[model samples]
Target: MNIKSVNKLHYLIALIAVFTSIEANAQEEIITVKKDSIIPKKEESKKSEEDRNVMLNAANNTGPREVNIGLPASVGGIMIQENGMPVVHAFWPELPTRTWRQSVSLAKPGLTKLSEVAITQGELGFAVSSETKLGSDTPSYVGNISSSSFGWIKGDVNASGKIAKNLYYTAGIYANYDPQSINFKFTNWADRTQIYRAGLTKKFENGKGKISILYKYSKSASITSHALFRYKLDGKVEEIDGFKIGRDNYMLPNGRFKYLDIKSGEYKWMDAGGRDNESFAHTVDIIGDYKLKNDWNLNYLVRGRYSESVSFNIFPTGMTQATPESGFTVKETGEVYTGSANSMILSYTPRTPLKTFMARAEIKKKTDKHQWRFGLTESLYSVDNFTNNRSFYYQAAEADPRQLVRQGAATGNTDADGFYNYNVGGEHHNGFDNKLAVFGSDTWEISDKFSLSYGLNLRWEKLKGDHYLTPRTPGFTLADGERTKFDHDWFHIGGSISGVYKITPSFGALADFQYTENNGLLTSYSGNVTPNLPKTRSPLMGLGLYYNHPNVSVVTQFSYLTRNNYLTRLNLVNPTNSSQNQVETVYYDIETTGITADIIAKPFKGFQLHYLITYQTPVYKNYNFNAFGNSYTYNNNSVEGISKVLMEIDPSYTYKDFKFWASFRYFSKQYANLTNVLFFAPRWETFGGVNYKINDHFDIGATVVNFLNQRGVRGSISGAELITDPAPYNDRLMVGTFIRPFTVEASINFRF
Candidate 1:
């Protein structure tokens, strides 16, 4: 072997010797204790101390906080960005990508409510699994109802009991409505959300085995929120002259919106917000667990789902103007111009139906010193045809912007129908996608204070579909008549190595490393241009330390991560020429180094404090690309839409039958664009709440969000792509999104 290779091997061996035990084995032992421990002990072990802190966090989850549900808000000191829509990524643009959806979302609704959540692997990015806990031998019923000052209401009820000899059943229903505090008019559907869900499960015993079937139905209306606020050159985000950041939005308050149907070529008005983009789904799961001879076990599951048409509708803010141009005319009145306006894009994706099926099987064997597991998984999904629509219009740049039309010929950009046709075209065709994976893992208990674990996964994925073959830019003359067919398949391998060591009963260390790969989804084909299908390589490494004491506990971790072959499509504006723009496809890489520390302390009875801080630098590398026949470079720039520092402190106190708690979260400034010249300043979000238990079966609570009443802006700059220098646009207005306003929520819980 070469000298460098030998040195690397020696370095790895040294690391393994330093951190001897594997985190995977440590996790397995911890979970076993949580499930099998029958007696409560007064003294705390290192594991018990960690568990206690977890329980404390769960018990204190009473306050109002930002709830995006299925959308990516923040994670690992960064916010996930949605730069393009590809079917293989997420059914919904804002949701987690396909590989992450199963872990991040409870799309099946009842799955989470009826199971015990668990993480079986040291690296969460590798896998997250849950164990179903329905149909307990004992009969039980639970229910809760909540109402908030902002016209939000939510309720759920669940019941489980034995129905027959060796048979049990569970049933539950949940419903909720959110008024969206940041937007105007609670009565309107703009930015509103409503959900209804019901589920039933049956479990029965067979010879030497147990089987369960679960069925769930869910219906939901979730709206997209995008608004306009001013971004200054000095890194200050300010509300427009007549607009309020939290109380105003670009959407119409009456739940009315108009757009031309691409297929019909006729204007139609639909309720704004999620009303025009509702979804319904039905799912069934069959699960089985069998005990085998020789210390072996077998587990299998089959899941099927059918979903009704689901759509996406949003009015994303665009270019802004201090005053309307001369020919600007009100669409409703057909009169002349005058007011300042913000150019807006009305983008719509019509509903498409879907069907999916998944099956998995796993076998496990246990020995005196080792545990081994092998698994196979197969998943298939089919989607119907869909189209993408893009229409443009001007709106008064105020609190509640009103649509305006520029006077032009019917054959020109702006039509007599009152809007400019940016591009309305077919995006996706009916197609099927499939994935198959085989995995294996082993954990070895090496000694009293050390363990080792390793795992490997091989996955085969295929995307078969056709896309509309039309250029997507404005002024393109070709119609959407041609189609591009794609049948692409990829094979990827991933592996993880982790070790944990206990220095003392109350102190421990951990080390982990993982490598994975990803490719574009079927929907990526919709870009008209042939999408890049290169495998994106991602590698992560982490080192951590934990300390535990009766009154205090701390956990700190240092992580380094790198990912290459990131594919994105950007609409770029020339920095040297404001009027010149182009749409380009680019590939880049990102490297992130970070540190996170979590500390919990209970100095006295009934009072506790928990603090968490994360500092990360996620920056672009080798970000050179060509657009409009010109080469550009953006190396060493900060990744857009992510803050470098995040911190939260939560404190709670209990006295008699009342408990009071509060949380404060801080985020550092974040870059607004890829070029990194514009940014939004740091901001804080605060929440506090109190709960009172009136009786064994009754409890009431109230929470206040944004208690400090700080108004701030966040997320990316709406349409300022590739604007390296902000000087020329200083005089012109710019738009972005803002945080929600102060709000309050209350709830009541009951048990029997």
Candidate 2:
């Protein structure tokens, strides 16, 4: 044999000998303890503690997951743990991305491998998990910011164990960047999300009771802007620069609205960054439970959370000019002057900071055939959004001998001391809100063939806002009696009923009725004559069938959903030409019908697949709104963000020590305007990964996201008042500003 081959054999032989000796010593210790003991204690042996945290192997693949998915807001149910335990939550914690677990954890921790004696059989338990990952993405739409490719690194470490008799504790730190982040900018995006969690639970051996305490802190800062694109309009390219959403679209006397362009010195509106947004929330949970009477149990839970969202706007260097189509007006003659572009302005807009506090409590019981629950919730919110849309207006040298803006300085830039007297009018809003709700629910398993569940909730809410216009240089100002305010309160009720029937162990059918209520952001900061906005509601009727087998599971549901009360605000010009303009709220209704199907198949060993698809039509049953002195109708139009067809497929395979999986997501084309003319194309994405274990101690993996490098918006919206937005901005896509492009990620796993 060669020298290298001989050395490898020797190494293997030495490892085997060492392990054999350890095993022999372990066996000898156990025998010696038994022979020397007079009375054995009820506690587990010290050996189990020494071996408690075993390195994960081929036995468990789902990883250590204590959190639940598809929480109370979505589809509801119990989540099964890898260790066969149950953790019941009173409600989905009010968190960002709170609807579900973000997705499959990339660092699947070894914590899932705790043995029965270490956790279930003994009173004491312990587990630890930590992981780090780096990811990359290539985005296609680079309108004015960032690059085509970027990368990010994320990490988390968590540990949980029994600290004392009947007491167990858990803590973890989660690090992330950007909202909806599977990946973020290589560097420039400057938005991030960080979260920390700590929890503890104690059980009383004498009374069949338990108590739990949990605390969470989360912070996020996201840059809210879109990567722009183009649309075809009558054989011409109409590259949209801005969305007409919530912010001020100032109109000049000649009926023209102007936005600045930094690169081309063009006069057009654009969705650019002015607000640096930040948000933070802290939560605390305390729960206590006890058994009472025969087949009866009592439980109480209370959760409190405080959160805030901040918006700050700053000026960027740019220039706004007057064009021939939208001419400047002569101050004395009230006549239009169409000429070359010539103007520049420097300005900034700031948003009122929003703060809120919420509390929730619930009492419940679970018996063999019946479940009962009661809950109450209270919330308070306040914000003072003050804005000023003014600038140091200047006259540019390029104008055609006639100044477009007549009143500005004869210079193209701000003065050396940054002092200028010109200022435009601004808007203000001061809002306050209080909300309360009471809810109860019951579920009964009447017989082996059927089960029923029902719930109801009553809610009351109050919103008050004071809105007014600030001073202007030459137009209507607060000093000219241009002030307004509003305030109002409202009440609502919503509930759900569901039932199921079983024909066999593997087959079942179900029906459900749900009534849902929602609202537009409450904008009642400080106001007089506030008209209480009506609540929005959606009542649903659904039916579904399910089949379960050792190798496959399938569920399909169809539903008809009715919608009511969409809130909208419009500006009204006084017929008397008064200084104060009126703002009014308008409402609309819609109807939708849809079908959802989900399937999970493990047709053979080492292979599995999950597929979900939805087909929905959200047509406007009725609608009317006025914008910029024009009225429009949208009856029978499909709702924004509701794609006709949406689908996702995830498939995975395992062979010996290797595993591979891929996820496919699809979205259909849709409109971005009420007229149904502005359209965005369809798109699909592919993401996949592969993992191979080198041995019991180490494994390596790689992931490819947007494998096809596809790009496009996933959801779209026409426009609306975004009270939560830092600045009044509109004309935007929902998520995925051109879906991320193809990029690869590599990682390694070390277990001990």
Candidate 3:
């Protein structure tokens, strides 16, 4: 079917489900109550009196009822009653609620009242945000291409409300625009891109049960200048073996002239950057509780969901860069020779579609003091129409000996037989995942001051994939003269156990442990080679201690994990000719440990603080390297991984109708690879913001980010060098060149 047909079908199915649900809900009784004086004595009278007293005691209570208005008024302000009841009136673009319960009445008419619905409540909101840098730096190059400074702008609007007593609807649209320019010193380029998205949701609520439907659509477009490096040789190119092209004297000393030639050229590069991925999903869920005569409440839930995604990629070549002067200058004094254009240049494209479905069921029994829950879930995944393509280019050149005697002669020109001469091939990957799981948790109060809770979960999964390759180039075939096909299936099993114990009124302790095992195969389309990777097993554990008080709370945790053997590629010198060879093999025993701390404090009025810190150590053991026809070993104990530390702090304060907040983050220098001068550099960042309320309907705020313009460098040594010398390997460090040091933005908010 065509793309349009598929989208229509998906929409039809969702619309049908929504209408059916609405019709079913309409059959129920609908009642309307008017505000009147119908008072109940004793219990009811006492509750009302207590609620009023609580509201009177609150310091910031402004409404007739008790509620805290923490959010912006435009976003649907918050309201809390003295009785500890919460009321929300915000239109969240992503999550919308339909019903607005303005008030409650104790008077009962006839018939049973299992639930009530109101239609008068709904909200709509709009917001915009933007950022700009405070500093400038020269653009850095990637693969010899430079990149420009970065910035972005975004805006969104959302609306939600109850369409009927029991039905609600919400929808919103958002957009983003970003433009960037890069200066490669030798060359400069720029790009501009924009994205737009819209989504809708409908929900039905009855008592404690709800069902929801959601749909979203998004698209993006971008334009960019071509970027690449190319050089033209002065020689005759030859069509070598099997469509492969190499210079007739490619490796010969001073082969056909110029050495160290540089050139600059322009071309166009365009792609969706993989963001064109689109998908649709549907879900049906039911959750309710039944009270038995024995005072036991039984809760049951069932849910199912199905989704599919269509994604595509395309890359083409014609796109070429120009060559710079040969030997410092295009010597007009001599005759030069050039080569043929039979060599293949490679390009790639990918396209795929995936679908998945899942279902789960759970049951629970609860009492005033304790609760127990158990559930089982399963999932099915599939991929269809998966395709990938690769293309190659070939070429040769020669010089005119007669022109070499005097002034320069036009450098020999190069040409290609046709774009079709480039070899192209495509591959497809289809995969699926099937999972089954069960879990249970319980919470109990052993005593008035001490409580305990624990949970257990277990899961099993099976993964499988079908891989194949198809050649698209005419008259070009693989060594085996056939397309490659590969298949594999693997399984994993894991479980977790966690518990929390309250040691005192303000302190607690928690612990958790998890373990999993997996086995799979590594397949290669190169000559039908398929290798099995060793089974891998990993186990993880965590322990934490917590402290809580009226003004502050703290939590500390320590975690450790270990993994079994894993396969990786290695490079080694050939035994006969000393050429490099690549191979894959398993390396066993990898472990990591980390310690973390979190703190929250509210020591004063209108003030809050949050802090987090973590330290980690990762270790690898039993290092074994394998190459085609060769194997090497290293002392497992000699490898030392670098240590790391990270910390963040956030603080906020509000005074005299003005609010301010700031955050800071720090990262210590870390060892990135087995190199001495190439450690990961340390970095620090900070941001802050302030807001002022001009009146009930207006407010203004400004925010600044990355105030410290800090740069970091990540380095690594080339594996090829490591295999030969192991030491003296030149470090490849990507240094942070330019950064926006800081960005400041101001926004004005409005409410009605």
Each model's lDDT? 0.55, 0.41, 0.33
For every model shown, what is its TM-score relative to the native structure? 0.81, 0.60, 0.54
Off by over 4 Å in 1: 1-133, 182-187, 190-207, 253-269, 273-275, 315-317, 322-325, 408-413, 424-426, 473-479, 571-583, 626-630, 728-732
How would you encode candidate 1's per-residue C-alpha lDDT over 466-494 as one tens digit per residue? 77667665522224356667888888777
Descending-lDDT candidate ranking:
1, 2, 3
**lDDT score at residue 648, model 1, on the 0-100 scale:** 70
lDDT tens digits, residues 562-609, model 3? 655543322222333311222233444655566777666888988888
Q: Residues 1-752, candidate 2, lDDT per residue (tens digit)?
A: 11111111211111111000010000000000000101111111222211111121110111121110100001111121111111111111111222112211212222211111111211011122212111112111100011122344445445555677777766656555422222222223334556676677788888588777777676654333222333333211122334221111211211212322212223333122212344466766666668776645665545555555432222211123344444344443545554322232333222234455555555567778777766666667666453333333322222112223332323332232222333332234566667777777677878987877666777777767666533333332334444466556676666666666787876777676656565544332212224334566656566777777778767777766565664433323222221123344455666767676766688899888867677766676567766346565778877544457767687888899998888776656655434455445566666687889898756778767667755444233212211122121223212112344455656565443
Error of 1 at 559 (Å): 1.2
Ordered by TM-score, highest first, the candidates read 1, 2, 3
- In angstroms, the error of model 1 at 488 is 2.0
Which has the higher TM-score value, candidate number 2 or candidate number 3? Answer: 2
**lDDT assessment of candidate 2:** 0.41
Better of 1 and 3 by TM-score: 1
Clashes of 2: 22
